[model samples]
Target: MTLFRAFFTLSRAAQRQLAFGAILACLAALANFGLLFLSGWLLAGAACAGLAGLAAQQAFNMVLPATGVRFFAMMRILARYGERLVTHDGALRIIGQLRVACYGRIAPQAPAILHAQRGGDLLARFVTDTDTAGQYYTDVLIPFIRACVCGIFFIAITAIFSFHCAITLAVALLLCIVIAGAIKARCATLSDRLSATQSRIQSELADTITAIGESLSLGASFHQQSVIMQCQAELSATKRHLAALENGASSLIAFCATLTALCILFFAVKDFQAHLLTLPEVPMLVLGGLAAFDVMSPLPTAQKTLAQVHRAFDRLEDACFSNTTAKSTSNDKAFSDYSSLQFENICFRYSGQEQDIFHHATLCVKQGERVAITGPSGCGKSSLISMLFGFYPLQSGRILLGGSDVHTRTPEDLAQVISVAGQDFHLFNGTVRDNLLFANPASTEEDMVAALHTVQLTDFLATAPNGLDSFVGDEGLQLSGGQAKRLSIAQALLRKTPWIILDEPTEGLDATTEQHLLEQLIAARPDATLLCMTHRAAVLPFMTRVLRIQDDAFCPSEEKKP
Candidate 1:
């Protein structure tokens, strides 16, 4: 989506809050301009009475007495305060919703889609861009609405008094709006470039932070620091240049407005001197014309704010909605009685590669079968599993679960019947219980302990300060690689799904730990179908069948029988 359309969509979602803010801003603007008109009238009346020596009688004849003026001033104060409060609160609320929406859109995307994106860039979008988008409501929408309302009202009132002043104010206001639009149009390309660079710098910083330890170990800290400094300098320069451009545009508009107001004052004074306009109308005309300019002084700043919000919208749109190429099917198919998963004549390859990773690879595992798939590195074993789990699309084949095509089933349906634990397991910063029971919120303490016990993690839990409630730190840094793998296994076992896929589950574990894990898997659910990919021959005895990838094809090895 274009940046403008994305911003409009985000604003449209908060239309009710925006409308309320707009109404309050309009009321505030009216009160503000009304005070100017009333003050001018009071001054004019006092001058006429002072010249005639009837000040008290003229004050009583005035539409707004001293008390009424005080009350109007207080009303204007309250309206301005309310407008600020409402606009800020509304902007915050919309930004909060947009963050959630952006996360929700990305949650279901395939691993390939996520792997292609930089983690740092995603973080930037969530933090800076979302915050910037909120300016649309607070800075641009409310102020622009108030200015337009006040300008139109002031023009109408002036026209009732003199068409010449009204015409001048109208033309000036139109010119101000047109000039603001031109400034925005010119800055659009620059704004987009700034946003992209911002995202890139943020992403790079995140990566640098994440790998700081490695960088220090490799003596690359100076290199990383130099890169960060360069990025910061570039960011500062771009911001300063943009600010200067916007300031220049605003100054030009303000100058034009000042000149126009002065011209109107000159005309009003000439007419009054010739007796064509009454004495009481002189101050009213000047102040009314000045009020029109006051209402429009901030229009250029509002336009600049809109440009920032538009850039933010562009970043958010690219992150959230632009990568739909990996969207899976949305059909609902029952997985309750899944007896087997079958890969029928499956042929697949990575994008831009000529050789097929899996050519007409056929495989099937019936209910309760413990199947082991072993092969050398780069034999498409992991790719085969990815295709089975609906992470990769088959080039020319069908994957069936319970006699139905996997692609025809919704992701939720497929997940219900299958569970996988790959080599790269992720653990969030939370209690150990949180990581173990992530898939099952309703799991009781007893269930958590049982899963841990089944995975041979009972002893490790006994030595911990808080047992299962111990904090694992970020990405389970508190645990060793083997401990993390065992935790992942416990999590998968907690689901107790019919089909379990474990890819290199014991890669980082000691021999004893690996052997213990294999024993536990055999004892936990012998009836559940198991598909494990590993190069360790120690796990072979537990498998009921062996499938090997040979010459880019999956075939039964003669070492095992079906």
Candidate 2:
């Protein structure tokens, strides 16, 4: 019943569509039962009539019974085909809605979610989770309902021949249903384990491929290959366990079905001898009992699917119903006018670590200042910048941008005041023009060309094929290191916000290129506040003021003025 709740979360239209598919499925099951019973009834009746005499066969009038046989057969075929068509369409629709819902839920949690999971794992959730969540309703729920409908109808029709015989068939069918339910519950854990393991293996394989170029460059290719192989072996072991359980349950269902059919046949023979049922109808009861059991075949598989559906819903619910769904009540006030950037009594640390990366830190960068922050590696310089931009919750203090509390302003509002070009900004698999357009979709070609010129890439673009329309491959793999870093700078400059935060933006560039680009950024955006975090000191002479991070606080640089 908990799994069934996942269905109602869809829109009413989708629920109705799925219900229609189930109705068609039930009709198809009944048709199958009707076709089997009528065929046995017709053939046995014909053989008995012919044995008696050719004239008796002529009197029986075979046309009506033969027509009944054909009717049920055609109905079964049509209904089954319609069921498949409608159910698949409904399933596809549900998958699309779920994809939208999942993305909507996870967007707020962003890099926070990525911090808890590998990017490949999130990618797998986007793709695989949506596909499996619908299977619980279509393959399992619909089929189970169809079997119940067919079971009841078969028993009711059998009662017309003899009340006592119907009671016997009903008991046998209920027993099989109970046993299958037990098997399904027993194997449920195995199904859940298999689903989880399968997803991990898929994510691991994807991560392996994405990082292959890096691993080979680091001369750690064999280490990466070993990790992938271990994951594959564990996945294989889980699959084998699942396959064995399913096979065993299927075998149990077959045994119970055979035993039930034999019991029904025995009762039918006894009824015939007692003169309570006709001799011609005996084969109909025997074959009809076997046909009744056919409807129960999906029961075992349905139980296995129930387990898998539970796992998928758990993952989806974790993503969609996460705590991040809480809406921010912060004001949407933008900081257009600037006086200074200030951090007062700032304290910060990662979520599960005790030591604060920065405790009681304070600094001020006056408006329209070009400041560079330099520090040793892993000294929380980037983390401090992240807090300044409102990327995460502050530990115990406030960050004021243009005198507004960073926590009190929304991210969209902050975007108007600040733009960041990080060391690891992504370039999607798209055209150079498309990537640039992401910063501002309404930007004209003239604005784009000007941004490229500021970053000193205009000459390179003039000689390149496809120019702005050239594909960047995945993560801009086709570009050289310097080209990728310069493109990122070009994107940040296009924002033209009141504040620009550059984290190691010129790392891959030569000294002349770095100095030229930094000088251009300062000249063009003389009114904008620039905060650059860099390891290299080549671009420092162009900065208006330089600060060095030491002992958990920002202060004037110890080095000589550039």
Candidate 3:
């Protein structure tokens, strides 16, 4: 989409605030130009009356009319304040909307798609792209509109005084716009390079930060630091080149505008000397033309802002349309139940890879049945579970729930039926209850306590003073590893879906705790289907069947029932 269309697609609140901000900015520019013209007229009128040897009273009367000029100045100040207020308000609102849109679009994307994208790269897009899009409305679009309005008004006023001056101003304005456009065209290549470099730098920075401990342990801190400096230096060089381009363009435009103003002044003076215009009229006309030139001074700066806008637009375009898989499909239903799951000849491969992760993988789980899957690392165990949980698309197979294909179901419909607790659990910084009831907002305190109890967390909660209301630090940092894992399982249990897929559910727990937690889980949801990935053989007796992922194929173990 074009920049303006994208801008208008922002939330209505932001659009309305931006519209008000633009109006205020235009009014401010008008008042500023009006004040300048009035001041000039007052000076010329007073000079003529004073040179004619009028009395003090006459001089005072001549200059008294300029009092209205002060009023315009005040109005200009107020308009400027209003413009700033509205602009910032609009900017912040747009920032929020852009962030929401970016994340919302990325959330439902297939895991294969997300896996192909680097975490650091995605973070940069989320933070930097949203920031740039916000500038499109605040600094570029609104100002451009205001400038056009003010430029036209100033030219009209100048026309009444001297048509030559008006024509000269118009030509200068047009040249500035044309040059700005050319600069924008030229900067396109550089802007894209800069944006890519920025993404790389952000990715490197995130990696460095996340691996700081590793670097230290490996005695490679110096090497990582050098790499970080290299990225920083590259970014600095890119920005320097951008700055130079802007400065050069600004200088050339300023020269052209100055030459145009000088030409207007020369013609006006010559016309007056030849008695082609009255003396009072010459000063009035020259002053008005000069005032118009003053109004054009900010045009070059606006051009620079426009260039930034172009850069921002390109980033936004990438965010909105780069990977089709990132777009979220419509969700018209809510998650409520999970009764059964079936996978038939399901196939999938990682992007840019030749080998398929899952080759004709097939499985079925009846209601209340508990199945355990065992596989070597990287044998598509997690990938298979992700597909089962609607986190990835099958390459050439069908996933069904209650005899219906899952692809035909909305996200909410899938959500209502299946819940998953993956190995890499994420917890928001909030109270324990907040993390537990994340899926169901209407879950009561009783429900929260029950879930905690099922996860064997009631003993810990009772001693924590705050119980379910206890604050878990960022990502549940304050909680022990076992506690964090149990919390994630508790969240899934709280959803109360018909199917629960747990990946490494007993990881990081003691042998006793693992067994106890597994028993509690089995007891808590006697009617729910369970797909658990585990390596511990002790839990095998509790499972109804075992599926082994061997040689990239899912095969049932040969433990036959009598």
Candidate 4:
């Protein structure tokens, strides 16, 4: 879709407010013109009458002209205030909606499709790009509309005095608009480059902050800082260039407005010399024409902003809605019964890697069976689990759950069927209660307390200042590594799905703690099937069958580890 069409679609919900804001802007512009035009006419007519003597002065009604000047002045002030209030409010609403819409479009395709994208780049699109798009409405749309609306009115009024003056003003306004468009086109590439530079800076800063401890310890801090500084310098340079262009455009626009005013004055004076105008008409025409040109002065800056808006929309579109693969046709409904998982001659490889992680590998886990897959570190064990849960696509072959392709089910349906507790589980920067409720919203406080007790987090919560209400800092930084892993297991247990997949669930815990955690998990949901991937022998005793991954294929272990 075109950038303008996409922007309009996103802003549709606030159409009424935006339209009303535009009307208010036009009213304000016209009121300002009236204030200046009437004041000039009133002053000139009063001076002319006074010079004609006492009878002319008495005949000239100063009361009506004076009242009109006051009226226009009040209208200008009130309309200006109303215009700013309405337009800004509407623009903020659009920005909020744009962020939400972008998130909604990109969320379902996350990690699976967005695995190649940097977190900082995506953050820039969500925050910075959305804000830039919102500026289009306030800085470009409303100003352009106001200028056009007031321009026609100004010409019509001028024509009432001298058609030649009106023609001069109209042609000058059109020339200014054309020049503004040309300047905007010229700045398009710079605008695009500026946006990319800002994203790069955001990305570099985000990466540095995330790994500050590692960088400092490894003595790579200087290198990382240098890289970020370089990005910042590039960003600053691009912004400087853009500023120069905008300033130049503004100066040219101002000069054009001045020239247009002079032309209109010259036409008015010529008409006066020809007896086609009076002294009062001459100043009224000149002042009114200048006021109208003043309304068009913002057009150049507004046009420059349009270039930035275009680039913003382009980045937003690429991040949120581009290159998305459609889900395969299959049953959208969640499985109603406990079903077996089957991998049929599957072939898989990671992106940008030549080696196959799995080559025609096949495996099955029968319903209600406790199965464990064992492998060394970096053996694609986690990748296998991710594939089974539909996180990655297979190069060849199929993964079926309950006799249906896993790809056929929506994330919602798949979520209902399987729950995973992995080493990389994320925790929100919220109260413990909030994170717990995320797994199963229907779980009660008592249920949460019981689950926490099962995972041996009861002691930690007891020591917390507010029990379940205590804040678990960003990504659960408040908790130890072992505590976070236990919390992840507790969340998985809370899900109560038909299938549970655990990745390195017992890697960091002590033997006693692991044993207790496993016992409680088995007792809590005895009917649920467990599929665990672990490197430790401690988890083998709980499994009915232990399969070892070797040569990219699963083989039944000769004997279960004691």
Question: Each candidate's TM vs. the true structure?
Answer: 0.93, 0.90, 0.90, 0.96
Q: What digit string (tens of lDDT, one per residue) describes model 1 on residues 1-562?
A: 5545645676676678778878888877777676777788778877777778665555546654555667668888898788788788878887887777778776656564677889998788888888888787778877678777878898898888777778888898888888778788757766776787787788888888899899999999999888878888888887877788788878878887788878778877777777777777877777777777766777778887787787788778777775634346666546665888888998888766899988887888898888888889988878865676566667898888888887776567777888888777799999999987796787899989988887778899999999988999999999988788888888888888888888887887778877888887778788778888888777777789888888777777655433
Ranking by lDDT: 4, 1, 2, 3
TM-score sort, best first:
4, 1, 2, 3
Q: How close is candidate 3 to the true structure, as a TM-score?
A: 0.90
Model 4 lDDT-worst window of ten:
323-332
Position 67, candidate 2: lDDT? 94
The whole-model C-alpha lDDT of candidate 1 against the native structure comes to: 0.79
Candidate 1 at 412: error in angstroms?
2.2
**Which has the better lDDT: candidate 1, or candidate 4?**
4
Candidate 2 all-Cα RMSD:
3.0
Note the residue pairs that clash in candidate 1. 120-203
Whole-model lDDT per candidate: 0.79, 0.78, 0.74, 0.85
Which window of 10 residues has the lowest lDDT sum in candidate 2? 321-330
Clashing residue pairs in candidate 2, if any? Answer: none
Candidate 2 lands at a TM-score of: 0.90
List the RMSD of every prediction in angstroms.
Answer: 2.6, 3.0, 3.0, 1.9
Provide the clash count, candidate 2: 0
Candidate 3 per-residue C-alpha lDDT over 1-562 given as tens digits, one digit per residue, 9 for 90 to 100: 5544656688475667778888998888888777766776677667777787747436456535577788889999999999999898888887887778767666666464566666788887778777876776666776568767877987887777677777887888777677666667556666677778888878877887878899899999899888778878887987787778777767777687668767777766777777765555565555555555444555545555666556666665555455534223445755333466778887887667798888887777788888988877787767765665556656788887777777676566677777888887899999998887786788998988888888889888999868888998988988998899899998998898888888888888888887788788888899888888877676677789888887667788754321
